[model samples]
Target chain A: MAAPILVFGHKNPDNDAISAAVGYAYLKNELAKRAGSDAVYEACRLGGLPPETEWILGENGIEAPRLIESLSEGQQVILVDHNETLQSADGLDAAEIVEIVDHHRLGGLVTAQPLRFNAKPVGSTAAIVAREFEIEGVELPRGIAALLLGAMLTDTVIMKSPTTTDFDRDIIARTAAAVGVDPVEYGMSIFKCRSNPAELPVDKLVNADAKEFELSNGNKVYIGQYETVDLQAVLGREAEIREAIKGLVADKGYQFVLFFATDILAEGSQFICEGDTDFVNRAFDIDCTGKSVWMPGVLSRKKQVAAPILAL
Target chain B: MAAPILVFGHKNPDNDAISAAVGYAYLKNELAKRAGSDAVYEACRLGGLPPETEWILGENGIEAPRLIESLSEGQQVILVDHNETLQSADGLDAAEIVEIVDHHRLGGLVTAQPLRFNAKPVGSTAAIVAREFEIEGVELPRGIAALLLGAMLTDTVIMKSPTTTDFDRDIIARTAAAVGVDPVEYGMSIFKCRSNPAELPVDKLVNADAKEFELSNGNKVYIGQYETVDLQAVLGREAEIREAIKGLVADKGYQFVLFFATDILAEGSQFICEGDTDFVNRAFDIDCTGKSVWMPGVLSRKKQVAAPILAL
Candidate 1:
């Protein structure tokens, strides 16, 4: 018998990463069963869950996926939520990536063979996976429905993020109805239940939602986003945050490091950086104090942060 | 108004590439019309159509897509049948790739932003486009149905190639019925109308259907397949074929170049390769006469030839 395929998300997985991996695995397994194929899919994660992901999984009574630090050569795997080798499990290039379901920009990941790659410009990978269920005519269980809806809500900030698409909103409404919950209320609850940054050490806060990227010019940039109801608390600790960013830059040899304190209630974000002030000013059209800048109505890192930085 | 998004296939487009681009554009336009969006989609091609593709287009009375050499920066585009930068149009990285519907392995093509990338491990890109039509609840027009069906038939070699999937077969039957033609009769007609290699120069015959790849070890491999009614005609000129392959290898600096003459009638293939004879022998387990070898029932370059070669 063929070995079961492992489905996983990138390290430091967010809510969408966790939910989409599980949802996509369920969809694949259901399709295989209908076709009488002996293929099995096991959902996994590259690292421990964040506080928000843990809360959602517990609320839905879904078990957290097994943690896998690395994959061996020839191991068959499917990636969800992320496709960049830097964000994936260690030794990912050695593994056979059979499929990828993601909602992020294309990274430097090449496959040795042709596989099913379903990527979309929507707010959440869960929306893409939910659409797959609809396309394949598979009914979603309540737990899966809730998990998918929660993912979409969190990723889109309840349809407020710039990344939200009409399809994502439609999937959010449908899955929310399937799970018997009000999307707005549930979305707010999930955000409220997130870990408080004030309670964590400066390094932990910076690393909690961090993502690293290699620019076209071969320079590495790291961005960390912390979503909260209060941004002033983080702003008050600007010196500590800058210290943490400096430590990350020194340790990882990053050319630049940025942190965004996103206020979910205000639908805005405060951007802090420990990078070249001239580049940051030119990229965002703001005077940098080597500290922080207030950017109202900028909550999407993919569009507002990563796009401009990559363009540079 | 936003400019019309150009939908195109790779260079040296085959039946599947041309048909999928046109068919997908039609489906996207239909969906946009339903949504009352002003976004327009124009079907295009990066290179000229082959004889078989021209014949299929003429039979359905469908206008051919416009030929495009390169795109300017920020031009929105959608790709079908291929996603590799080496095979795509010039200036593809500068253009905004809004979507991709392909059947080939993912290449080193990185998009600046997330887009809709619908790739599948199926036999034909037309099958994926047809499935998209079904998903969007758009009824296929007679001309489109004919073009799509013809593409699937040719790409899968009348369901005889190992690359064909059950999904491809089902799509073939459904699309054939929709076009009011028996699949077998139409498929044979398409094959019989292909360009006769016996009439063309050896160089042209070798270049007509060539595809290039960069193996994991950074070696370049070029594989060209010619579908013919009689493989003996090609085998009879084995010396000339080898000379053509050698010319290609020297001109392109390829590590190896292989030419496969696939017999539609005999359901087998004659392989002629130039360069790295030892590696080719080890890959296929055939004692190379340094000229040609007959591999009965090895009809798929993607599955039978390329996969094994890339594995090395």
Candidate 2:
């Protein structure tokens, strides 16, 4: 048999990423099998599973891949979803990373080496893989199409996202149509299926869009976004939102905690934060004197906000 | 005091539905408050919360609504994700269904009566709710905006579904931009977040897309989608897929079970079955004599595939 193609998702393996790795691996295996190539394909996950994905996968009759915390020596590793992060993928054999397909911001994990890496600033790595399959003239089975289409649709926010390209839309349209989904209607059903809110907790609200970043001092700071139509309405819940954020800070033991009170209608951001003043000053270019600061025009932490602060 | 707008989501509440109901109620309340009107808004769930939604809600510092079980008399209800189904909403008042914003096909539950229902066959009920916020001139807060945005994006599968419309796209664009999301980057992030899958189970693969409909004889037939890109490549795995379906049938005790195997490239559906002759015969217009049923132009059981078979 040919060398096995070791496929793994990002450090925080999510449903689409994990499924994409699996689906892509399955497809690749088929190609190998048909070509009479000595190759075996296996899917792997770096991190533990999220609760929701766990339930969904269980209900769908998909087996979880064997956990591979880090890449093994001589194992040809293929990365999905994440840009290689050395810290997260520590202990992994770097030479084994032969291919990378991801949709996240490129981080400092990839080594300068020869690899078939494709990083699209699109919505999903699955979309990239889907494009690859299309380009390679590989036929997609319904399951693969469903997962890939789902990933593309989810990532591109149904093509409403600014990251969506004509290519992404075209692929999404074709994939959706091929899967026999009135892409629009099917997308709607997914939304409808998601709206039921019973037995939910308030802490989940804070962490819903939570992310962690390592500061220059190696301290971990947590940033989260809570979007709404009206700032005042969210402001009215400020006590609760703040209380929850404080609780998260205490629990997570982070040096900084920030919540973005974004006004979707106003096209503005209100920063609710507790952290060092010098750090804040450097990050936001604003001088402040208290543990709390609310600023405007900081709606984006990625392009407009985070990078600037990180530079400071 | 203006009448309380009673808000309720679908049966078996999920994160998107619950967040939409709560988030929209908050927005409406804010709008009413700004006008100096004390409009009482109560968020209710159509059914009990699913396990995963519970975790998210709990994490978000939001509380799940009281279990409705069904509709009752005297309460004015605004339907979020669900249509009016007595069985689904056992004890709640149907007469109070003043408005319905849904993304699914209109069921007998709501159509039996005349109400201000908006079922535009979009991707998510949150999109409908988002529209409501826009039309009412209610500004969205970051939390509500993020929640609604997430619901819309996730359900629409990032707008790859055919049911998506210009309205959906416009809303998503405005919302993503307003929330300071590079609609592309944010959409891509959410999709990437969905990639992890180490915790998934084998059974979930078969059940994630399972749907059930009652026959005229009180028999309930369930059809599930187990999509893949290549089935023949894993020739031995077909047996596993089939056995999984059989196990589900035995476990769930359904009158019949049908699994749709779709070929995305070939654009056809392969029906795998373990059901009796009558259920299979009625559901598919073909003989069920121990062979897989291959149908052209069949994919979604909810729309393209199931309706025709059920009508038969």
**Who wins the TM-score comparison?**
1
DockQ for all models? 0.79, 0.01
**Per-residue lDDT value at A199 in model 2:** 26
Per-residue C-alpha lDDT of model 2 across residues A36-105, encoded as one tens digit per residue = 8787888877666544445445544677777876554566766777543532355554436656666554
lDDT per residue (tens digit) for residues B1-312 in model 1:
769999998787778889999999999999999999999999999776878789878877989999999999889999999888878889987888899998888886787789888999999999999999988889999999999998999889999888899989998898998888999899899988876667767876787777888876788878888888867777778889898899888988888898989997788888888987555677889966486888999888777888778777
Model 2 lDDT tens row, B1-312: 666777877654544567667766776677768768776787876554544345445544666766655545666776776553522455553345555556654343412122344545556678777877775678776656766776676555466544456768988888887777765555445544431222335455456455566554667767765333354432335567678777767887877787766543354667777766565666566875456777775544455555545544
What candidate 1 gets wrong by more than 4 Å, as runs, is: A275-279, B217-219, B275-279, B287-289
- Model 2 residue B273 CA deviation (Å) reads 71
**Candidate 1's error at B260, in angstroms?**
1.3
Q: Which DockQ value does candidate 1 get? A: 0.79
- On the 0 to 100 scale, the lDDT of residue A202 in model 1 is 86
Question: Per-residue error at B168 for model 1, in Å?
Answer: 0.7
lDDT of 1 by residue, A190-223 (tens): 8888777677788777877778888767888898
